[model samples]
Target: MTEGTIPAALDRAAEHFAGREALVDGEVRLSYAELARRVRQAARFFEGHERVAICSPNTWHWVVAGLGALYAGATLVPVNTRFTARETIDILERARVSALVITGTFLGTDRLADLGSARPGTVLRIPVEGVEEPISGVTEWDALTGLDSDFVSPAEPDGVSDILFTSGTTGRGKGAMSSHRQALSVAGAWADCGGLTEQDRYLVINPFFHSFGYKAGIVAAVLRGATMLPQRTFDVRETLRLIETEHVTVLPGAPTIHQVLLDAPERANHDLSSLRLAVTGAATVPVALVERMQTELSFDTVLTAYGLTEAVVATMSRPGDDAKLVANYTGRATAGFEVKLGEHDEVLLRGPNVMLGYLDDPDATAKAVDTDGWLHTGDVGVLNERGYLKIVDRIKDMYVCGGFNVYPAEIEQVLSRLDGVAESAVVGVPDQRLGEVGKVFVIPRTGSALSTEDVIAHCEGELANYKIPRFVDFVAELPRNLSGKVLKRVLRKENG
Candidate 1:
């Protein structure tokens, strides 16, 4: 089994699986030895930087740049590609990023121009879809690759490796810091559970910016020497083509991704017999969907898991589990984690893989992890006698929409700034397509006229598309408790 820092893991993979294919992104294919060489070259560009941020879709460039930063002993901070310029700038400033690796013109948006003056001191622009208008002062991806240096920073096991930002109930984003040991431990646990091997061709559909893709997808593949086929964006046709051509054996994503593939009209025309494993979670997994994946999609093993940014891959179903069990419950705890129910049936986790703490927030850290070292996951769940975990509700008033965590407080804070919006409350309502969609109840200020379009338009400028409310309702007043706290339960109940 591979152990120690991420950089060490990469070197081990290069030595053990030197001739094996490592990454296949579009036309770029690299062996383990070649990937190590490129990572070392890229590391020299980020040698002096302390924090490096990557804001791009999943591709070969993202993997190289991210691993390079880690090789240089720089903390990696991945920014969401869907975030607006303002939102991205906020994270960059908070993390004190000194270097940035951004996509050059993707989907008609020039990310370099969007960042403007807020960009870090050192910027490496990846020509993902070819740079439309070359911006001066920004180093192109090719330029960085050409640089030569033998600088390799020694990474400590306990040193912080990455800071992944997740929204808090306070309407602020909290950076969850994890050490090299913690990150690898969880990745190894996940890889072991999934039976990842060198012969496996894993198709990573999850965005690299998210924990699922970065740690579980990238790090796990490196640990097991699995070949990675990264998809820049999720397209049904492209996914089918990759499975047939690349002989993809492992596919893990949200239930929605599988549902789309199964429901696609042209699904039968493609060859999908190569698929062997499917791991899904982040939202409700229907029993029918899991059964169909086995029967219709020919997936040998289908599993479901429950985790948060703080403790990724805490609990996961095993391979032999039935479809009904896999769909109904996120499997028993793995990765040396102890799971138990606390007050109100809240799921409490204590493990080595839990995050060290929220970045620079001691107060919040103390609130999350008690002195007993048990991290109080605000999610309410049930633990069966057999040690399975079934998530029931979220105490944090958060929801999962299309596999993305959406905090109502974050949206309410953005709406509070909008003109003619005196007060607002947001809740997650059931949806047929997406597991849940945001529905905001707004109380307009006296003598102010506000339409649903106006409220949505205001949010579009300030928030990510997933964070914005899909449905808006204008109300005269909000329901509250005696202490004047907004009764969100009442709102959710009424909406449901």
Candidate 2:
């Protein structure tokens, strides 16, 4: 049996489930043997490039390209698909990347033209389902993956497999390095945690760049025998149709995904009996939503997991946990990891799942992962007597009201339970009397009249007066990054 890395795992899967469906993208379906052949064929094309990047949405070509990079002994870098031309190249330059396999014009952005020599590399453009012609001066993705080459690089268990950038909610994103072993360990742990099996059909809604979709979504499915069905973007109607038509068994995404499903009007019309497992995470989860997932959505196993780009899949709820465990806490440390709280209740973690460090930024890395190897995940949370974790909020997201500390997540949790509220975000806005007070922006459920008074009144007895939002503003939606994190910085700057 091949061991210690993704390539090894792929070889094993190809041998075991070679004839089974390995990938499904719209009408294209490839068996494990064909997928492995493409990976091996594409691997021979890398030619030992020092660094390669993939800036594409969820698609089968992205999967083959990424796996081929690994097998070619190249360090794989994932650039955010939402990044602008300049923003994307800035990362490629920082990493000194020599190759980039980017997508064609996608979702209103010409990802290829965005590069424009800002960071020079052997640029390769992958045309998605519809686009048939390859751009001039770029290698055709089909021509590359079609070659049947007998090649496999040596196992690189300790070598860096990926350099995932921080979400950069605050400022410039920092690249975090993960070894082949560390990355694969997270994938294996997630597959086991979710009880994924060969019979599973996984629909990946999260982007390929994020840790959730890259390691947990794509790699985990390959490690197990699950069929991968990639979605480019999250559209409510499209997601429901895929779930019903494809019989997607395992669908994992951010909490917003589940919330949308629960709130969608045509939900009852679709026969979604195949959605058996769902994995989600957020700052605050209302218990009612969890119940609705199990009862209304008919999900047999609904889990909430916690992890950052630095350490993906740290903790996750398990099957048969109570509503409180499923909705309240992010669950105890997943297998092969340790979790503790720092002085101010910041969640501290250390394990194989943890990243090596921020690439080429030792000072920032030293500050995050202490000399003892504990990664200080800036997010704050509390562990109950039973050891379940309830994430309060980002420590930086917390603010003082009337000289008392207040956490936005605590208030948001209360706000979500209120009638007519679909979602809410609380940020500290300037206030004369208290230095800084909470200002909440809410998105009302469809067809409901949620007023500012309705929001303020809902928090009356449910929260401390200091924690209550002094100002309430109803908006169509809160500004969020592609990863589904509320851009509180944007909120703070707008309301500052």
Candidate 3:
């Protein structure tokens, strides 16, 4: 009944399952007690460190490092492991994070050693057996693994817990100042909505650096006493076997993962009946994909959630949501919040879950969170008379042709429904006379002989004259970020 803060909840978990496997990485499983002990040891090292930047995959070690920061009362800055050296430097400088914890040989660079020499804080390097050359000033992880595990969880509650950087969708990345309470609030909401239980086992495929996985995937599982099955990187076959062997019951990932799993050959042969629920979100998903999951995978309990890194999950669909309802929109934008359509149908939300402000940029923070606390989501949506929300498109991504507003999602949805098309991306391209026009990027289904003309012709019938794409670009696959959302900005730059 410790209902106050995240640190308290974590302590409750440590007591609840002292010997139960709480985190798994390959063949290695750390019991809740062992995980807690390691975190306490690391916490002792980070007692007064300015900030601890952890760069690791979704493994038991990563969780221990995060909890250590919490207990040490130091701000936790989790850098994306996929980030290049340049990107890492930007985040490190912006957050003023001096100390760093990184895995061995990330992107051909020793991140821990690099940061230790370049920055002004302690650097701890985690070595994978048989891989890396030991560096001076880099504390070996094994040294701390055997340290006394009886350190105290700090009671200081005013310190910032995490400074999570946004993915820079609009412009440059900005760190969102998150307190322990803010992060836990998001985890609590997910637990309430998802019906998380100790009996459930989670497959953590989403990157732990992102708020979606950190808050919804990792913290939610921990709060509910569920075991977290970690994977260093996603492999189709590996994921199937893990589920079959580990009996993982819960999976939270982007729509692309669900699509990939449904298409994988092992899915039919694997015993995935233990998968009681699956959650998909992070980007706009086609209704067809959701339908395919239900029919093909027999996942009766499926949910499509909506959230931003600024405040993890805002809204989600529950079990009783009409099957047709979950098929359409990304759930009713959050119960503890209110959403309104702004100019050009932009979906604006005001709620307690919205962050206080961005780390150092007050102006940008002002623009994102208004005076009344409504966070401008920049997404276009429409609420039907029945109060069901349907996303139309992103406001910035919307195009105009001679004063006619065009939502690319409408065109893309139509494009995806076409036969022989596998994946599609629609973006606005510059047009001399029209100001802006729609362009479609098509990825034909494997072994399909679909032509650009066939796709355009199909869209012509289903879409309005202006909404029809003026040009079609065929790519083998769409360029996507780590979260699996198509990087249309990249496509726009390429075409431009």
Candidate 4:
């Protein structure tokens, strides 16, 4: 019950679930006892000074590494698996990372090669199972799992325990340092808000590298003593099959996953009656998509959350709220946080969940987190009289035309509602007369005759003249990452 660490909560879960299944990946089922043992070995392995970097796939391997690293009273650095070697190298060096625990190929770059040798004052490589060993000093992840599991770790309740990396589109990635106390607080907050308990079986299909997955998938599940069903990669059919067979109680993913499942032909065949709670976050959810997901999937309980990497986890739509409110707003923004509108309508957040600071980058941290300790969220939002926060768009994504500011999300939301539009990304383009103009990149529904004018016309009726996209480009599909977030930067570079 101390400040920074979560070992106590993990212990509590172990005692509560002991022989019960804690993790399931295909044929790999690890009970709470077995998981606890491996975690102890990890703690024992890290008896020295306080942190190790974890860069692994979204399998059981990742879970073991994260838990073990935490057991050692060490903070964990979760490196993005999709980063290129150059990007990975820049983050590792910037974080001043000590040891590394990595797995198989990530975006075609070997973990060790991508991570490279640790810099001076850095401990070399530590391999996370079934992979090649280090060129110099390296420890096998499996070897630690086999070590004696009875080691008792010292409690440092309020210490920094994890460094999760967040990519800055403008520059190098920043490491958001989260304490064990802060991390577990987030898990507890999620459980309390979502009504999670031991009876719930949570299915985790999101990438563990992201804050939403890490908090909801690992930490929250442990705090609630709930079982975790993890997938290496998300496949709509496979996920539905698991939900039907495993009697999954909780389903959590980004809006994209739900959209894909809604379109999947097999979605209706599966018996998803056991799925009670469905939690979604990361990107904005279309109101129509939320309704369809509820009606089609028969989700008994549904909630949408909103937060950023710096906060680890911040806001959630309280369980039992109106479906329309849950679909449209980012909840009440949580009690631990404070939010205010900055210049240009930017939303700023300050709270315990917000990270201490970015590692080794005071300049970037200062720019993000002001002297008043408020982290500018770069998101533009409007707070209704009821206190619900509906995000309008990112600060950079908002375009100005003549004089009026145009929120791309507001425009994109309208475009997405059009009959033949599959997905859309809105950006600002330079204009001759007007200061700027809206440009829409759209993906049409298969076999539909949707044109640029059609999309522009749809927006014209739904949005203001200044807000309507002046140029609309039809593409087969929009560029997105694994999490279903449209990569606007990719579209901008391609069209700019």
Which candidate gets the maximum TM-score versus the true structure? 1
TM-score, each model? Answer: 0.98, 0.80, 0.78, 0.76
Q: Which tens-of-lDDT digit does each residue in 1-496 have in candidate 1?
A: 2248999999999999999999999789999999988998889998988899999999999999999999888899999999999989999999999999999778888877888898988899888886456677888888866778465666778889999999999878999999999989999999999999999999999999999999999999999999999999999999999999999999999999999999999899999999999999999999999999999999999999888899988999999999999999999999999999999999999989889999889999999999999999999999888999999889899998989999998899899999999999999998877899999999999999899999999999988888989999999889999999899999999888
Off by over 4 Å in 4: 1-4, 106-109, 113-137, 397-496
Give the range where candidate 2 is weakest over 10 consecutive residues by summed lDDT: 165-174
lDDT of 4 by residue, 1-496 (tens): 3434678888888898999889887788988888888788777766664667766667776787788778777777777665545556666677666666666454444656544454324332334344564455555555675677776666576778788875464423568887777888887888878888888888887678777678877999998888898776678889889999999988887676777778889987999888778887655566787777678888877898777778855668887777788888888767388777789888888887788788877888899999888999888888888777888766666554643345677666667679988888888876644546888888888999987778877765555356678888888778889999888778766765
State how far residue 191 of model 3 sits from its true place (Å): 1.6
Candidate 4: worst 10 consecutive residues by lDDT?
Answer: 119-128
**Candidate 2: regions farther than 4 A off:** 132-136, 167-170, 398-496
lDDT of 2 by residue, 1-496 (tens): 2368888888888999999999999888989998888888878878679788999999999899998898888889998775666567778989999888987778765768757657454777788635745556677677785676798676489989899986333435689999889888888888988999999999998888888889998789988989999998888899899999999999887666787888899898998898899987744567888898889988899998888778888888888898878888998788478999997999999886788889898988898899888999877889988777888756667675543446687678778789898898898987644557899998989999878888888787555466779898989978889999889999998998
Candidate 2 or 3, higher TM-score? 2
Candidate 2, residue 267: Cα displacement in angstroms equals 1.6
Q: Considering summed lDDT, which 10 consecutive residues are worst modelled in model 1?
A: 145-154
Local lDDT at 369 for model 4: 92
TM-score ranking, high to low: 1, 2, 3, 4
Models ranked on lDDT? 1, 2, 3, 4
> Could you tell me which residue pairs clash in candidate 4?
3-157, 3-158, 4-157, 4-158, 4-180, 4-181, 75-161
Reference-based lDDT, residue 198, model 3 = 86
